[model samples]
Target: MKIRVSDLISRKERSKKIDYKFEIPKFEFEGDVITPVSKCEVSGVITSDKDIVIMKAKVTCTLEMNCSRCLDTFIYPIDIDIEERFANNNSLENEDVIIVLDDILDIAQVVESNIISSLPIQRLCKSDCKGLCQECGANLNKESCSCNNDDVDIRFDVLKGFFDNKEV
Candidate 1:
């Protein structure tokens, strides 16, 4: 995931093509594990303008993730476009710029960070997932349940009591 940029910095090369494929280890986010099912593929180019180096790349990968609703495993595919800036001097250090050290750029962190941020907060197996029944702990998407789910909110208890005390 590291690329040599001495030629670009020295004005010897205007741009360099990048194509790499690598594996990523499983990592945990919140309480779920995100495991990569395929090799991460990155393809793009890095160009130099004055003292600044810009990298634009497209990354693709598939991950095994659990649905937050039904807790079922599903394949989550990712296709992201990334653009990053780098400089040889520390003066360019900021939110959008990375300082390249030792004439080499290590892009593994950048790629992983982009992938993690792109994940959905609530992963669902389908767009209309039925989730599970809170009363009987049964999967509503699979079968029907007889458990009573008519419970009312505690804030309405006073109204319920007033109606219960009335006589017809």
Candidate 2:
């Protein structure tokens, strides 16, 4: 997913467009699994300006995820538009810039960053999805647990018996 910026770096603008499809495998990040379905299609225009490369990308893909409530697998479609600026060699004094990449910027990396950025702050199957029960470990959405909510503490009874025996 690397694009050669030779033409863009020459300070000459070119009306070049290319279409590409890429597949991103399942990966784990910060204990969350990211499974992307199908290869993302990224088609865009790369324009060369004075000491800068202008890129406008339109990408489409699907993200596969499991419901935290019912543990069911689900897919979410993703479509995004990316506009970025890249600096040419010896164009700027400092390397640290708002630009994405200065040399042979990896398109895959760009797409990955975009996908990660677009992710939901919190993902749920539904708005009222009942999570799993703590005691019986049952999915409350499908069925209810038999455990009583007002159960008394059995440990306190054991302590009471121990205190009674000490009195004897």
Candidate 3:
């Protein structure tokens, strides 16, 4: 969502409080689709300190994601704290600083970035999920596999033959 900072820029007020709620459509990242289950809520206060505008906001949203292990879909809730600074003038050349343009501040990019970074690298359906069995592509969590459990690696066959020929 976009927030107007015209009043603050005009020096009418030293600070302004903002509270916004918006819906985020499903977005794809790295071939994975992330869909939000509900509206995202953001509430914060923006303060103008000299030529800089500082914003601190709390964002909360619930997302639907697939488990990396079992591919099961689940709902994940996220809460993130954001602190950003915008330069009212062009004197600041830091790459990390966001420049305000036309007395408008767009927070959609910031919110999307924070949510993506907050996601876990590996998502599991459960703590001890057995996952899929390599032998017959069976789900180990649901049933036991009848595949041979004592299959030996071919790389160790030479060593096995040498040991078998020697008497203990």
TM-score of each: 0.86, 0.73, 0.80
Ten residues in sequence with the least summed lDDT for candidate 2: 93-102
Best by lDDT: 1
Name the lDDT value of residue 60 in candidate 2. 95
Q: Using TM-score as the measure, which candidate wins?
A: 1
**Runs in model 2 lying further than 4 Å from the true structure:** 11-13, 90-102, 149-168
Task: Compute the lDDT for candidate 2.
Answer: 0.73
Q: Candidate 1, which segments miss by more than 4 Å at Cα?
A: 158-168
List the candidate 3 regions with Cα displacement exceeding 4 Å: 148-154, 157-166
Model 1's TM-score against the true structure:
0.86
7-120, model 3: which lDDT tens digit per residue? 565686778776888888899766779899999998898887776778899999999987776667778898989998887567764746688767678877777787888888
Clashing pairs for predicted structure model 3, backbone only:
none
Write model 2 residue lDDT over 5-69, tens digit each, in one string. Answer: 66556744464675879998787644569798878899998777666667788989998876766
- lDDT by residue (34-124, candidate 1, tens digit) is 9999999999998988778899999999999998997888899999999988888777676467887887788787788889999999998
